[model samples]
Target: MSITPQSPASPAPYGAWASPISAALVAAGATPLSSLALGPDGDLYWLAGRASEAGRQTLQRRHGARTDEVTPLPLNVRTRVHEYGGGAYAVHGDTVYFSHFADNRLYCRGGDAEAAPFTAPGRQRFADFVVDAARQRLIAVREQHPDDPASHAQPANALCAVGLPGSAAAGAETVLASGHDFYSSPRLSPDGRMLAWLTWDHPRMPWQGTELWLAAVLEGGTLGTPLCIAGGPQESICQPEWAPDGRLYFVSDRSGFWNLYRHRDAGGPADAICPMEAEFGSPHWTFGNAMYGFASAQEIVCTYIDKGVSRLARLDIAGGRLAAIATPYEEIRELRVGRGRGAGFLALLGGSPTIPLELARIDLSSGELEVLAHSIADTPDLGYLSVPQSISYPSASGRTAHAFFYPPANQDMQAPEDSKPPVIVISHGGPTSMTVNTLKLATQFWTSRGFGVLDVNYGGSTGFGRAYRDALQGQWAIVDVEDCIAGAQYLVQHGMADGERLIIRGGSAGGLTTLCALTFHDVFKLGASYYGVSDLKGLDQDSHKFESHYNEYLIAPAPHADALYQARSPINHTDRLARPMIFFQGLDDKVVPPQQSESMVQALKRRGVPVAYVALEGEGHGFRKAENIIRTLEAELYFYQRMFGLPTAGAHAAVEIHNL
Candidate 1:
């Protein structure tokens, strides 16, 4: 590699600065975290995403001083129960049970035994598992799609019991409960007599409304007369768990914040243990998401997201007191307590600004934390990292919006004096999802190279509460776009960013927001959409079962959806879109199909607007392959350079912008 002398460090524009962070570095640095579990003893398990492995999720185990991969090659431990699936595996004693993504079948393996299929495969998919030792079966949520070739394929979902190998119930599926539109968290009581779960109907997302049900587990591994314990069409209930003493507990947002509530054994009313203005749970976008676990019968170790930051606490179940547990983390995604009568350790997966997503094992007696695995093996050099600053700004309709601002932070060189930084406003996908202050290399890649990034949580993001998340209800493009614009204006008004050089980018739901902001407004000069939604009606037709009717709440209801579909869809308003844009799409994406990006690109081409389209073959909703990530970042940077008329020296990473 040729080295350039720093003696000639001169003045440069905000987006045109040269830095050490490169597209290849950012692509190889990111590793997604998921599905944390606690094994016997001090062992911990988690799923680490390998972009180099073609975006496969691998099961990693940390036992004592040794950490190893539990799921080998030719086998990916993942599920497609709801398309956006999670909770793909469960472990009992030393044996591990997992659902394979390839064949959609349940497989079993352990120390001495070889990996083999345990459950018969068909059109059935399983996830969100609970290993019932007493019943010698695996309890899981199964989705059964019709086998007809030319069918609409509206599948049926149910809670099922798959027998373990070498057991009486082995390879047999006995349906315990059925007829719920969606099901999650099939928890068994400590005594193994009762079962509890969360269920929600269509048109109403889980956050909008859901019900917590409990039923008696009969002799033949079947449920009897499920009773609706809490929640309704108005309340949202999540994370149904049973403590050691047979006390049923759950998280509900009926009081505006998701807090802890427990069911009384005497058939009386369930009481709130510790009521606070904090969110004890998050949106169930994927299955098997957990935030709290019982440390013991008398205590519970939990993580709560308060104002976009996460905190860990121990709740005294009987004393009605909550005590904070200090840690180096600000975001906790999953937590699980040690099994059996001896509650020795607490296993959790969490992250912070300086820390990558890691699996930590906490000692219950001494309050000691040990990191078992790292999401990314090594952290970036401290000199090239961009620390995030949380800022709350005013938006339309007298509302407030949240964002994480990372100004250009290159330690090697500085921009010219009094030169305002060019800001790239980022919208998080999920539109329902909140952008946390995590140390993501992708964010640092821009910031370390002298581009300021504004990651907006907006109004309808989680980590605030139910009310804040529902802010996008019926507003969709309006609320999200306004919040983003408000954040950019706030920066410009504060003299922190260049008003004329503003940019916006996002993927999935955030992509829709980015598209709308450029099409309807002129606040941003350039934009990028990663598999973004361009047509509202097309989304309603192409969405999966979990989010099929999601547009009803996001935009409008059936009869009126047609009008909003025309007025709100960016594909229909392309005539107003004159700004330069770049489109990145995954051809295998089923949630938001490539047609959304393809149609928008065609419209831009017809109008003779400057545009570039990059499509990846095997990628999905979000990019995970290393090469694809590198291509996307390089192409985006190249597009922006061409749009802003910035100069690039040496062998340039080139992208051809049509009609430029």
Candidate 2:
């Protein structure tokens, strides 16, 4: 629910307007919710972040009308596989298996008993589990890290089966499939006679290319000779699952768009199921990413992204006909069908422009939605929220880029007559990922303070067709930076923002874009980087095994990468950066280490350019602690107010702006 929209009552300077949407509220209210799953007994389960517990992740379950925490305090249900872990836990019947983040070991819990470690404490981490009831094991993707922390060798990833109690290999992991640089989605057949999984080698991210393999589960529990069913070095395949009738189904990008396809183990050509110019699959950044799931033998419940927005539909597997399921959500993160009496229900994590990310159960028969968990408990007034407008603007070479434009929205206040609001251009990370118009309190934090924002989808972002996604191939900084610049220019040209006060900010990969725009262009007068990349060589050298070779596709192969790295790195061109900027970095971030931010701060300081740096201890990659989030937001707002010469309305701890 929201307050009715109302006209402004008084005038206020942009970036200085006071609002009830404070930084503290944004941190406390924006609780992270993800990893939606359905239990065998019609129960709903999902992972929720406990910000107060130093950003610990806890598993929560809802049976009937009662909701309770499954993993209590001090027990963080998370995995470190690939550094950006997902699919950390899975449930079957009354049993649950999950990876304990602290020790990187697998734990099991059954019925009402306390969780206990099943796997020996070692350097191995497990994720993406599928229970093999017939075999008494759980098939999962295992990453074996080197015992010596100083070792330069990368962790070995493979498809391994962990034996449950009373099995021959009980309390041990037996390798089922190996020899691949990375592996995920270890799905077993309904009858447990066959297995299917995805694998990709170095220099190719899962989105760039992946191979789907199928093999017979031999009598001795070892996999027989495996055969490649689909995908290649040029084609990307995702989420391979066995249908109820034993036919294998998966998503492939051979059509320039990720679409559904089915293959029979009986040896026949794969058939495209409902081919369309939409994305039925996403980049396999983490494990267990399911865009579609089996609802019945003939019916499939799925979600696809078309032009940066998500749509829910029921696909007839036999006829290849898709029937749209009407829902308020503009973005659906994950979807899964229930079992037994709850088979008619679909569990998902979805959100819209008005709704925060939440765990929901939707009934196919009645189209009724039941809210299971909310990312945010309290909602802000409608007048304080800024609704985004999906927009596309012209960029270099007659090409177009997409973005979501948010205007300054405050019912109690408006800019003085005829004054345009200052705009913050945002570049999302993943360079491979796309941004949706979900109700994010972080974005609203700026809008409620009279600051307009432009969230750029940029070139190479997903949700668009493969062509648009491939636009940044080998043009990472150039293409992504251009789109952000063009978006800000478009906003200014349309009178939606003040050109003189343009700002750009992004984290991780987007941080590189922000730095590039501030270094190479004169459009943005101010900028912010949250754990941004300042040097490509530094990123490639320090990045984990998952993204170590990502630059080869984003920039070039190793033979040519050195030259491009030297030429395009923002740290190499800081002399051209004369604008005021602020940086936030996590000291423990192995993805984008603190050195990236420190070097840039020193460079700007020596040149007498206004700069501020905030290094957070006990944090990594992205900020998770509530205190750090609140501090960074307040510091950034203060930095912008001071740099833009706006009057500070509320009490904000002053940030030391070097050379200000």
Candidate 3:
């Protein structure tokens, strides 16, 4: 099924070009891979998203040359600790502990046996686990939801220890530390005598500020009074790990960058291990993020982001000299050190422009690579793939914004001569997150269909140090939206895209950027919002506890917040929105509820503006099921074709556009 290049005799219009990359293929090709963990027996464990099976996440194990499923069907290996869960499962020897998404109950499975619930089924969820074999217990972050489902109170998060079966207090959870708004990354010392964890308060996201706590492990699996060794309201800390030699090492932005630091003693100040402008850490949007691990007592292997790209390196702990470790990946999402026979091996989830995200184990001694799992079983040929060009463009107020520009790249199709392809500007979610140049079929689906794609890493994005990340401190919508517009305009000005057909689209926070760009300005001709925020006020009300007070940092606080929310809300100013737009919403989404998209769609319909809405049932903030992913991609493509008056492929269902 090789696709040969087409001759330049006659070309189709940009939007109407035929592509081999169908919507169905995109859904099937993009698999989610995350949370790499190395077992004591040298077995590799990770999570794989099952799109065909209702988007259930299954725990996967790689032992020797064989790969198998660890968690049985109907027992999804996930957690809802922060709603955006990670570190859902932890492995110790042959035993695995995981949180079931359905009941929020912690389940324990040993070897090939059926998984059994260990924690009492209630409104409690757990994540970021550490095994305390010496005490026959598991230390983790436990989020206790109020018993009253109708209550408006936020869930209480704390560091708790769950007794393993056969222990004196089997199935019982002992709260070790409380009074924190959120808790994560409970690490045990090599001797199991000490524990270190991270906590942060409300109104400040983990990336904005957090505290690292260290405490002595008292007898009977209890913790002594904890001491805050580093971090505060002005400093953000992440990934606090205990070195094999018993020293505490963590990432801190105290130097205006997330540099590595080591605390030799509780009473002494932490020493900077390697202070550089590069980011050795990322925003703590989810749980269990490890940027570096001890390869030995004196050497450390780490992944760092420099100028929005990731690089693998080895650091000499004593000399603080960093030496680059060559790898094919341009982005490393997760990293962990191997154990036992796998010692000196680094297990990571990594990818590059031509490679889909994959689980790989790299041998430090021999520089050998072994891929354990591929996000895409079979990726598209390189001829049809679009290699991204890392770009920096001038944005509002003479500030430079970064993005990855992907030009139309289909081997079998080409647009007419002198006709620039229509571009789709993508404002990535996480206004706090940074987008990498990893090979994503979703972006390729657009480029392969004669569309240029610009993935913007807006002002608030992580990487490039703390000051750059703080650019969106109180100017979320304004700064993010301006960056997206600037990226699109840069492409048009440089003759890379059609000036008259600029399109913008985003999801979650990025959705807010898309809506603002289309509503407040006339830069984008059309837009698409996938579970985007249309009304800032409504978003704050419907947001979960993890992000309830997030707006206090993204915008203003208290009384002044209401006015800013009203002024920035796209739904409030839809009267200025005359562009054609399509909206997608998941009925079960808790982050940005369906009302956000529905309200905007209704506004557009009433104003006689061409608009379409596609709602998916049983979906959450993001579409996970294969069918829904296919449907959304196809419907969006069809919508753009019909709006541009281009010939539709008609290979998928047509979207019903009102006021067309």
Candidate 4:
């Protein structure tokens, strides 16, 4: 046999230049971090790679210490990659239940576990779940596609339940209650006799307004008539939890800031357990849990944000006093409190002057903090990574905004003796989401390659409070675009980046900002949008049940929507775009639809501007396949290099640049 010499993987030109270096680099599909639930036997249950080849939604069980004691829950298989709806997993007794997104069915693992589809998939999209083991039923929020004309105005959603260990055709699903446009936080009473959940309707996101409902479970496992326990049109309630003592506890924003409220009986008014001007529930935008667990019926432990700082707080329900359990950390991503156990774990990020996001575990009672993990990088001997400096920039309306700036640094690339490197301004999606000092390999990817990065927490972003988040009301495209422009200008004025080489990139709502910025302003010379919204009106009409009416606040009400939608949509104004841009979209995306990107690409082509468009099939809203991610990053790097007249050292696709 002839031995063939293996070719080496191509190395990055600016090797070892990345800052806040780590050993654990982000794999193509690797998430920065995730939360896990501990099983009754102390086995850890977490979602690993199982749903798709690009990403796995496996229910992993880790036994014993650091040895090879980890075993995935039986019946791990690739389901759907995007919009499968099921991600969060819950444990009841020895059985493990999780949502199967691909089939829109629920599955269980334990005792002769054969992964069979439980609930029928199509009529509704299933989300976060609560298992009533004794009752052999599962309570979940069902987001159903609308059916009638009025349904189009307000999408249909309801708190529903289904029998576990049953067949999909068995018709096991029971509608607990209806009239909810969106529903979440389903909690079953410890005795399995009562159910408590949260719901909010159209023209309002969950954070803006929500109601808490409690219902008795009938003998046949159907829900009795729901009683509105707490909240109204102006109030927002979240994370409804049933204490072991039969008391219903939830977080409410009744006092302008989110605080904890408890309802002892079916007809009683909710009593404020923890009251403060700090937020207990984060802005209801992302699909992750915020407040993890309740310690006791009276003592509550949760995460709260005050003035952009995330802290762990312990609430004394009887005294109405809140104590800061853990000192402020850089960011608290997830918190989990164990039942009857004073000791709980927290997934924390401590941003340092030299590190990006350092993951640590916090013990509530002892107040002991331990570093559990840190990101690792492949390169070595790189100069210490510079920490992001949090700064504020003035918006177009003269209001100060927040952002984090990471100066350019790389071990190999020394700026031509005197020239400052280029800068990349990033806008986070959700228009409601905020960028934190969390560890993100994508940011390092640019910075490590000799580029400065500005992660902007523009107006309408959360973590600062509601008023700040509501600032983007009726000003989505304008406020977001102005903030990005102002942030880049601030960097240029302060000599942080080369003004002539400024670039901007964003995804989803952030992508809208990117398109609007490039079209409305001449500051950025290059831009990239990932599965972004190009037509605001298109979104209002075609979006999913969860966000069907989101544009009502972001833009304007539906009756007067045509003019405002056209004005805010970048697709309509593509004729004014002069900067070189790249676009990425998922064919299966139901939120923004592929037409959003296609329209923009066609408009730019007609306008004779330089633009490149790439669409990934079998994906939705976001790219998940490893090959697609790698290709996107590589293509983007090449696009930037060619646009900026930088030296290309390797073979890359000859992309067709329109109107260049």
Q: Which 10-residue window of candidate 4 scores lowest in summed lDDT? A: 1-10
Whole-model Cα lDDT of every candidate shown, in order: 0.87, 0.90, 0.90, 0.70
**Tens digits of per-residue lDDT for model 3, 1-660:** 334455542378887777767777777776798888888667889999988888899999898899989986887888878999998988888989888999988889997788998888788889999999999999999999999978877899999989997788889999999998999989999999999999999889999899999999988668888989999999999999888788889999999999999986937778999989999999888898889999888988999999999999999999999999999999998899864454478899999999889999888888899988889875777888999999999999888999999998877776777889999999999879989999998998889888899999999899888888999988989999999888888998999999889999999999999999999999899999999999999989989998999999999999889999989999999899999999999999999999999999999999999999999999998999999999999999999988888888795569999998
For model 3, the local distance difference test gives: 0.90
Clashes of each: 0, 0, 0, 17
Worst 10 residues of 2 by lDDT: 1-10
Clash number for candidate 1: 0
Ranking by lDDT: 2, 3, 1, 4
State each model's C-alpha RMSD to the native: 2.2, 1.5, 1.5, 5.2
Report the alpha-carbon TM-score of model 1 versus the true structure.
Answer: 0.97
lDDT of 2 by residue, 1-660 (tens): 444445556788988887778788888887798887788667888899977788999999899899989999778999989999999999988778898889988888888999988889888999999999888999999999999979878999999999986678777889999999999998898888989999999989999899999999999889999999898999999989887788889999999999999996577779999999999999987777889988888988999999899999999998999999998899999998864554488888999988999988888778899988889877888878899999998999788999999998888886788888999999999989988999999999999899999999999999887889899999999999999999999988888999999999999999999999999999999999999999999999899999999999999998899999998999999889999999999999999989989999999999999999999999998999999989999999998998899986446657889997
Which structure is stronger by TM-score: 2 or 4? Answer: 2
The digit string of per-residue lDDT tens for model 4 on 178-280 reads: 7766777787888988888877777788777888887888887777888887888778777777776788778877777777777867455678776677778
What TM-score, computed on C-alpha atoms, does each candidate reach? 0.97, 0.98, 0.98, 0.87
What is candidate 4's CA lDDT for residue 617? 88
